[model samples]
Target: MTEPVSISLTVNGATHDLVVAPRKTLADVLREDLGLTGTHVGCEHGVCGACTILIDGAPARACLTYAVQMEGHELTTIEAVAKSGELTPLQRALTQVHGLQCGFCTPGIVLTFEVWLRDNPDPDEAGVREALSGNICRCTGYQNIVKAVLAAAAEMRRGAGA
Candidate 1:
């Protein structure tokens, strides 16, 4: 057995000191160690975005990242997307557009959209689709997902410009 390695990860703007196995994946660390189960694990590989999380405001495949390697890194999950007890514009948009069905992919979808919106708050249809290429939604067929992203972009833009 490998020795437990200590790591401090700032998640959702909260710092957590964890002692974990070096081989533990970030996904496990988030779900098991930190009890942040919103970060799901689908393929246990990098292909599926089920285990996606924001590392320093960018989406990353948590399943592929080691817990020990994330020391001092800022992590964000779906739970942290909201601020001041208000749903993020993306979250509101998803609800408004019925973007989720089973809700299994919602966290990853939210993370992906969060990152995409930061980069392109006024993304076109094709741009929205391209940005969500990595996040697969089996139930929604992606139409609502696209609509949600676009709607969220508009709302966020209005809020920012106001």
Candidate 2:
């Protein structure tokens, strides 16, 4: 067995020090070591995008990334997307548009759209659909998800978002 490596990184605005096996995926470290279970494991590989998280403001699949490689990096999970106890424009829009059903994939969708919205704050429906192609949600059939993203884009453009 390989020795566990120690890492210190910021998660959701908090610093964490953890020791994990070298082969431990970032998804495992988030869900197990850090007690942040928002990142889910679907395929265990990077294909499903179920374990998406933001690393230094870029969307990354936590399941495919190693915990040891994240040392000193800034990570944000679904838990941190909302600030000051307020839902983000996307979250609010999702609720308004019924973007989620089972919610198993909502965390990944949220983080994915969070990153997408940063660059495409005025996204059209087609643009939103293209941006969400990576996140696979079994429920909602992606119609409402696309609607929510476009709606959120409008809300964000109206100055309801950061």
Candidate 3:
């Protein structure tokens, strides 16, 4: 048995002081310790983007990260996306366009593009496709997902102007 290590993790703008095994992945710590299950675990090998989350404002696979390694970093999960109980533009667009089916990959896709859209407020279809390449969806064929991303980008740009 490994010794439990105490670490502080700031997730979703909240700081959590927890004692977890050193080898425990950030995904487990978030879901099990912090009850933030929005960060899903798919492949556990980092190939699938299902466990994607933001680490210091960048998308990273929570399953590939150790909880202890995130001591000083700011983590953002799917739970933080719609914090105000209202859907984000991306969320709304996804729903309106039917971008998801099983929804197992929705959180990761949403988290990935949430940050992506911030940097790329005016992305084209190719850019959106490249950005979405990391996430794998067995349900939707990615047509609607692409449309939703483009729609969200347009909507966000308009909102920013307002």
The parts of candidate 1 lying over 4 Å away from their true place are none
Predicted structure 2, TM vs. truth: 0.95
Clashes of each: 0, 0, 0
lDDT by residue for model 2 (1-162), tens: 599888887899899988889999999989988889989999887877889999999999999999989987899999897867999989998999899999989999999999899888777888888778888888889999998888888888879544
| Residue 60 CA displacement from its true place in model 2, Å | 0.2
Best-to-worst order by lDDT is 3, 2, 1
Model 3 misplaced stretches (Cα beyond 4 Å): none
Best candidate according to lDDT: 3
Error of 1 at 4 (Å): 1.6
Per-residue lDDT over 1-162 for candidate 3, one digit per residue giving the tens place of the 0 to 100 score: 599999999998999999999999999999999999999999999887999999999999999999999999999999988889999999999999999999999999999999999999999999999999999999999999999999999999999993
Query: Candidate 2: what lDDT?
Result: 0.89
In candidate 2, list every pair of residues with a backbone clash. none
| Residue 67 accuracy (lDDT) in model 1 | 85
Best by TM-score: 3
Error of 1 at 94 (Å): 0.7
lDDT of 2 at 42: 95
Judged by whole-model lDDT over C-alpha atoms, candidate 3 comes out at: 0.95
Every model: Cα RMSD to truth: 1.5, 1.8, 1.2
